[model samples]
Target: MDKVFNAITTSGEEGVFQTELCKSFSLDSRDGSRLVGNLEKQSLITREKALYNGRWTYKLVVKKSIPVDAIEQKPIDLSSVEGAPCICCPSQHLCSIEDESNPISPAKCQIIEEWVTISFNKFMMIQQTEII
Candidate 1:
């Protein structure tokens, strides 16, 4: 399968014919067709009918390549935002202007002010330490 896909990709945008693949890999018509069908089913390639020496034949074209890096992507670490105020706020979901009950709006929210003040104080302390 890899060999067949590699061969098709090597042909680039021009693509390669089913008969060409059969000849190149020494595969029979049934096996070649089955391989192409599988590649099409997986969305790795596309097959289209075209004129080949006065006969209709299929072309094996690569749709897209599976990125090796994408398969091994590093998981995101949200450690920095672990204790953030908005995320920890108990009334966050109920905080809205339209809601009449327990309407903890953002403009006059005490929770946000306290959190911001504490964070600012910590930042100032860090700055003072650096200056000293």
Candidate 2:
């Protein structure tokens, strides 16, 4: 099972066809199907139906899992909002969502909108760089 799972994972995002995977392990069709079925039941892999060389087959792909420890270790980074307009605005104290009397509400603030747009673009660029 471990070997089968590792093989599927090593195959990467494109995944391996059911017949080919079975052939690689020298297992018969029944055994191979059963093995992959167990993996799918365990939520360790997913099978997609595909046409391989005009023959129907199942494509086995590994499920991506994020470690809980990694999520716990990563802290929320608020540096992106460092230069936001609201941070140093003199009327920040007067800004209110429910009060119609306040003219400095974030909902109608152009400066805040521009700042958010710029910050979002920067965040997207950083995300793309990290992915690369």
Candidate 3:
């Protein structure tokens, strides 16, 4: 399954025809169909109907790549967001997504928008510095 997925991934966005893929691996039609079907069922790949050399067949396209390493889980640091404008917002008590008449909603808050813009710029700068 991993080998099949690797082959499809290497094929890029154009993808590989199901018949050709099966042939490359010397897989019988029934087994090959089941293999690709399993991958499709797992959401690892998508099969699209296509006409290749005047013959109808399905093209196997990679949907998502499986990570080689397990991601490290770390506790989120809330201190990083201590300076958020909403933290000390005077109208934070009145803010509500459901209230259409609420004038202090986060969606329509200029202060929050400005804070986000500044924070995003700072974050980008930090990323660029790390890259350097």
Identify the leading candidate in terms of lDDT. Answer: 2
Minimum summed lDDT over a 10-residue window in model 3 is located at: 64-73
Better of 1 and 2 by TM-score: 2
List model 1 lDDT by residue over 4-39, tens digit each.
899999999999999989988999999989999999
**lDDT per prediction?**
0.85, 0.92, 0.89
- Positional deviation of 123 in candidate 2, in angstroms? 48
Model 3 misplaced regions, further than 4 Å: 64-132
TM-scores, one per candidate? 0.49, 0.52, 0.48
lDDT of 2 at 87: 73
Ranking by lDDT: 2, 3, 1
Ranking by TM-score: 2, 1, 3
Q: How many backbone clashes does candidate 1 have?
A: 0
- For residues 31-126, write the lDDT of model 3, one tens digit per residue: 999999999999988999999889998999988655657666687988567578887889988988898787779899999888888888898999
RMSD to the hidden true structure, all candidates? 10.6, 14.3, 11.4
